[model samples]
Target: MIVVQNLIDAISLGSVYALAALGIGLIFSIMRLINFAHGELIMVGGFVIYALAGNPMLVMALSAIIVVTILALGMERLAFRPLRKASPPTLLIASFAVSYFVQHVILMIFGSRPMGVDFLSVLGESFEFAGLRVPRLQCIAIVVTLALMVGLVVFFRASRIGVQMRAAAEDFTMARLLGVKADRVIAVAFALSGILASFVSLYLVAQTGTVSYKMGVNMVLIAFVASVIGGMGSLTGAALGGFIVGIVSVSLQAYLPEELRPYRDAFVFLLFIAFLLWRPQGLLVRRASERV
Candidate 1:
């Protein structure tokens, strides 16, 4: 039962990371730029939820999604689109600039301290079934992750924009030459990423019961690593990498001595190194074609 419970917790955590990685992976697929500021979208959504606290649950959720999506679109238009033709390192630096700028802007408005938030209190509850205890949020997280993954698959397979996005991911210059609107596809990618960030915000606030400007930073970092481990441009690989990380993290916490628990992340990274040494191309390798 204890093992089962731990598995549930790990899966829930992985689901959250998987959602985050999918958001990052989608954008990287098209842009080849890792937006460190992606975390700010999650942070912004948290603040939106915090600001709208006590409103109807549905209202708060919709508002967060809308606001975050708009900001994501704005980020692409204002910060990234102009540099679309820049070198990879230049784009990376721009992402870092956007990350720091937004984080500080949030700090100025919300202050540096963490603020308690009671969004989705019910998800904090836990239950027992089949002799195993499980968190409601964990169950919901798993379900939501599965649904989103399925929905994305369907969207990519059926929708015209989705096909264009996939084509853009494969080879952006060719896709645009084939009449895929680069702006529309890239904008849609950011919008979708923002939507994912909002959900990440809700789950995080519910789990932590507090909102901090830096809350999304560590998660985004982990999600980025997960994306890399799974294969930079492979959404399915990113999801798998997230689960692998969650499982490894949870198992280390469970098995490590109390004195060594503080070094768990060091151990995780060590393992990551080992994994990379074994399969540097990642679990799912992207096509060899040039991105642009």
Candidate 2:
């Protein structure tokens, strides 16, 4: 029973990380930019939820999604569009700059102290089925992640804009030459990323009951690690990497010797190093192609 519970916990945490990774991965797929500021999108969403604590859950959730989505589009247009032709290092720096700017803005407004949010308290409680206990949020997280994954798969396969996004990812210049609208595709990608970030923020706050300016820092870091481990530009790989990291992290916490537990992340990275040494291109390597 304990083992089962631990496994459920692992999946729940993995789902959260997977969502974060997917959000990062989607933008990377289109722009080849890591967008470290993606975390700020999550942070902003959390603050939105916190501010709307008096509102209905559905209303708060929708507002977060809308606000974050618009913010993401604004980020692309205002911060990144002008730098589109610049070097990758420049784009990377821009992402970091945006991240800091947003973090400080939130800090100035809300301070460094963590704000408590009592949203979704019922999900924190445990329930038993067939003599096994599980938190309601865990189950919901797993289901929601799976549904979103499936929905994305369908969207990519069946939607016109999705096809254009994939083409742009494969070769942005060529895709543009072939009549795909670069700005529109990139904007859509960022919007999707923001939506994902919103859900991640809500879930994180619900689980922790607190929101902080830097709350998204760890999540974005994990998302980056997952992207690298899964495959740099592959959304599926990013999600897979996130799950791997989440499961390993939880397993380490559960089974490591008490004294060594504090070093769990160190060990996780060591394993990541070993994995990279074995498969440097990642599990789902994107086809090597010249991007103009």
Candidate 3:
């Protein structure tokens, strides 16, 4: 029963990681650049929820998504779009600058203290299955993540805008020639990423019962590692990698010697290194010809 409980915990945690990683991977695949400020976007979503303390649950959720989505769109327009023609290194440096700027701006507004929401009332209560107990928030997170993933799959497969986005990711110039608005598609990708970040932040706050400006920093690292292990541009790979990392992390924390607990991250890093050495292209590779 303890093992079952641990597995459940790990799956819930992994679902959050997978959602975050999907966003990261989507933006990377589309724009061919990493958004270092992604974590701050998640932070912004949490802050939005915090600011709107007593609103209805639906209102709070929609506001969180909108705030982050607008922030992401604005970031692309002000920062990334201008640097689009620049070298990859230049764009990467700009991402770092944007990240720091957002972090400091958040500090100026909300200070460095942690904040939290009363989700118990909104999410209702917990329930038990067999000998294992599960929180309503966890179930919500899992269901929402799965739903979003399925929706994305359908969108990419059936929707015109999704086709354009996929085409843009495959070959920007060619997609442009084919009458796809590369810029618009990239912006939409960022918007979608922001939404994913908001969902991730929501569940993370529920799990931890609080939020900090720096909450997403470590999470971004973990998600990035998962993305790399899964396959940089492969959404499926990212999800698989997240579950693998979650299992490994939980197992290490639960079963490793006390002296080795602190080295859990190191062990994960070693695994990443091994994956890179063994398959630099990642465990699963999206063919160059494949758009998404």
Best by TM-score: 1
Off by over 4 Å in 3: 121-125, 288-292
Model 1 bad stretches (over 4 Å):
288-292
Worst 10 residues of 2 by lDDT: 283-292
Write the candidate numbers in order of decreasing lDDT.
1, 2, 3
Count of clashes in candidate 2? 0
Ten residues in sequence with the least summed lDDT for candidate 1: 283-292
Backbone clash pairs for candidate 3 read none
TM-score of every candidate relative to the true structure: 0.97, 0.96, 0.93
Residue 89 of candidate 3: its Cα lDDT?
76
Candidate 2's residue-wise lDDT over 1-292, tens digit each? 8888788889989998999999988888877788999999999999999999988998988999999999999999999999987877899999999999999999999999998998888999888997788889888889999999999999888999999888887878788889999889888999999989988988988889999999999999999888889998899999999898999999999999999999999998999999999999888988532232
Candidate 3 TM-score versus the reference: 0.93
Candidate 1 lDDT, tens digit per residue, 100-142? 9999999999999999978889987888779887878888889
lDDT of each: 0.90, 0.90, 0.82
Candidate 3 weakest ten by summed lDDT: 283-292
Model 2 RMSD, rounded to 1 decimal: 1.3
How good is model 2 by TM-score?
0.96
